[model samples]
Target: MDLFKSFSTLAKAVPLACLAFGAQAETWKYAIEVSQGDIQDLYAQEFKKRIEAKTDGDVKVNIFYGGTLGTSADATELVADGALQFANISLGHLGSFVPEIQLFSIPFILSENNEVNKHLMTDSTTVYQGMEKGFAKTGLRLMSIYSEGEDAWAANRAVRTPEDLNNFKMRILVSPLQVEAFKDLGSSPTPLPFGEVYGALQLKMIDGVGQPISSVYQSNFFEVTDYLISARHQLFTSAIITGDDWFDGLPTERQQLIRDTMTEVTHYMMDEVPRLEQEFLAKILQEKPAMTYISLNEVQRDAFRARAEQTRQKFVQMVGSHGQQVLDGFLAERDRLEQQLN
Candidate 1:
């Protein structure tokens, strides 16, 4: 009788111990607007892996991909409300919430040189210092901003000059700056949801889209488009963000771990992007042999560059003096980085 009672007590204690262990583990929810294997997904996965490993499984990240939880806008709100722990959203989409973010959408604002652009995105004070307060005001902790690739135009027709884009209905992010920028280039800018882009192109709802080369290939936009124009007008930048309150509530050590891990991931992404751009473009061509690739010469690109000033003026007008200050700082940083690189 004594032995049986001891055995029963041991079984009960074992389950209690297991329950306590499970209760101590933390599960963080991460949201991304792209499907698995996309650049953002890769970033989220790497972050999840690093955090979990560093925490020794005390923290686990559950990623909700392809807007499984909701759209990018919805996910942003969820993060701000503390319903989600993290989200990777493009600056274009974020412009609606924080208009100052539109600085990034201005035409040719970033350097064409990959190294300069990488440093601007990763290490620039304009983003980490200048824009951090704007993000915090909206209840988000801006963790890191990184680029996927230079934004390219995928169209049904070849475009070599600004005149070639006349009346070209282009699918743009729902950003006022993008609308004005494309308008300056003589294209009718149509703001559409990212998911609806491929179908809209197939159904002829829009003419072309400006996106990173990887997105064009990963989303299979190449199937519906005929030409890939290497415009290099802007870099496709995305930010990793979390709820301001949630991040602040964490222990100081955990916060430092997250910051350090994100910096590592940012560097990882910068290195991976150049290789991915080449691989994705090759795959796009292999699958679409009839597709044309157009690389505009400097003289041809100079035409588009001239019109960028008009868009920059419009950006300052929309965001006002604060926007101008941020823009000035960003331009100064870009210039410094370019000079250093040269």
Candidate 2:
């Protein structure tokens, strides 16, 4: 009586072949915009290998890296329309389609890798079920959420408190929650596509960006920015998504194989991405001795957390009843996990 078992029974009642019109082995395309060396791209490649091997070639996953399929927004559309089989979409970009996913954008909720890893490893938790239920409403099947790391602020200037962030034009993905959160932090957030970020920063179009350590390194943002602030304001989470109808059409065994492979890969990433974060941060500091690293004091950190709680309240109002249900469950689960960890 697990969620997957319930899905399997539902999948059996429908003819998946009716949607794709073939009984032959299926080949799925998983799209991501990062280069191969980036954390997300690496995980996509690993998911592909594990899935195809587990299914013994009965199911094949092909990865389209470097935005071959399109931007993250484009990837979400492709998955929903059933043209793309899978994608690793950021919660910010995903909020446009499913507002409930924006809960992950609530700053300081999962402030450390350990809290994130807790959610990543436990699939049967209330938060996990709530996330799956939320995604189902948007017609996307949620395979799993991978911990990308806590978001830190990278900019051309140092930031130690909310006052230091005044008037900074920060780059953010297309999420209103992000827009509101940064505005609360005293910055003007400019929503931009990830591909244009590098040039924008180089041209002084944006003064900063908030992203995980792996992204700051992999995207070469560290080279352009002069400061790295360990804000750890939000846990950067990404989803492995596919069209619900297409996934339901999949034979139950193939569905199980996909889910199992995702679980394996999630655990692997939980270990690997943190290690990469350390290595990347060290490498960045080693190469650019002039880059400044700022660690916020408790009072400064608390200011951001207070702003985040206010932002979360605004979001609860925005999504109304449905979002409230998920947010309540998520916060409760977060408290339980925090207690367990402490």
Candidate 3:
């Protein structure tokens, strides 16, 4: 009788122990491979803070920065597999799904803050739902979009005209849109990883690269590239994501808590990115003081813009039925948002 009583008591304690540990589970782990200086890192910090504040110790968020967990491509796969609870990665590198994200790298649709913002914030046929759909099928998700600053061309020499670009070799990501755009302008684009870019430029393999000014500053590309064109070619962004299975398994309240906190985190991220963008652009001038910053004349700007138009048409065809509608829907939604902005 005594042994039976002891066994029953132990069995009852097992469930209690499990509940106790569950109550004290630390914050979720968030991974961003970018440096502490990057916007995604800032967002991760804000998310950690907000989730902790709201959950009152029930949840804590742990973070890793500077590719500590994995490269961006690997991060996406890991997050989908539920090996990672959360991550922020560039949609560009996740070519296995969300192919429409490539449209951002296109020369026109995402070339400016207003246009990109319109795409993200505006409501219409343009919520990137297809991206959400495709990611769902693969066990990843779309949590939020982190702001990436406007892009520019940094070169060894002053690139004043289309003719100047044609004579130069540039590093471009191997996306179809980028290849076609560079080819259209007469420059041959070589696809290389961001880490490899500095070496390529040093070895005279590439005469220039198109990138955000802040990225140029962070990587110290200003040393090799003597000039910058505030080309603002595209507004870049990263996707915050989590394992779909993990997200689906969470209690409804916990899901809401995370969603709400992440929104606050996004605001902090939005403010921080633009602030850093301006700071770096200004620093580039103040620090080096000798590097030329190219401001395109209105006529030159229009010429580049004109060349980008056909590329949009190309995207519709390239993305096929799903992406074609996304293209059409985005354009109409973009027009509406621009109207609201005006």
Worst ten-residue run, lDDT, model 2?
A: 115-124
Per-model TM-score, in order, reads 0.92, 0.87, 0.86
TM-score (C-alpha, index-matched) for candidate 2: 0.87
Instruction: Estimate, for each residue in 1-342, the C-alpha lDDT of model 3 and write its tens digit.
Output: 999999999999999999887776555778886677766666787788778777776787888875687677777788888888898876566544766766666676742444446346322335446577777888987777656666677788787666777768888765776677676665778888888888787777899988767778877788777898865556666678899998999999988787767666666566577778888888888888898999888787667777777777777776777777887777676666667665
Cα lDDT tens digits for candidate 1, 287-337: 999999998888988889997889988988998778778888899988988
Clashing residue pairs found in predicted model 2: 16-249
Query: Candidate 1 — what's its lDDT?
Result: 0.87
Over all chains combined, what TM-score does candidate 3 have? Answer: 0.86
RMSD of each: 2.6, 9.9, 4.2
Report the candidate with higher TM-score, 2 versus 3.
2
The candidate, 1 or 2, that scores higher on TM-score is 1
lDDT winner between 2 and 3, please give it: 2
Candidate 2 residue spans exceeding 4 A from truth: 1-25, 111-117, 120-128, 131-134
Candidates sorted by TM-score, best first = 1, 2, 3
Best-performing candidate as measured by TM-score: 1
Best by lDDT: 1
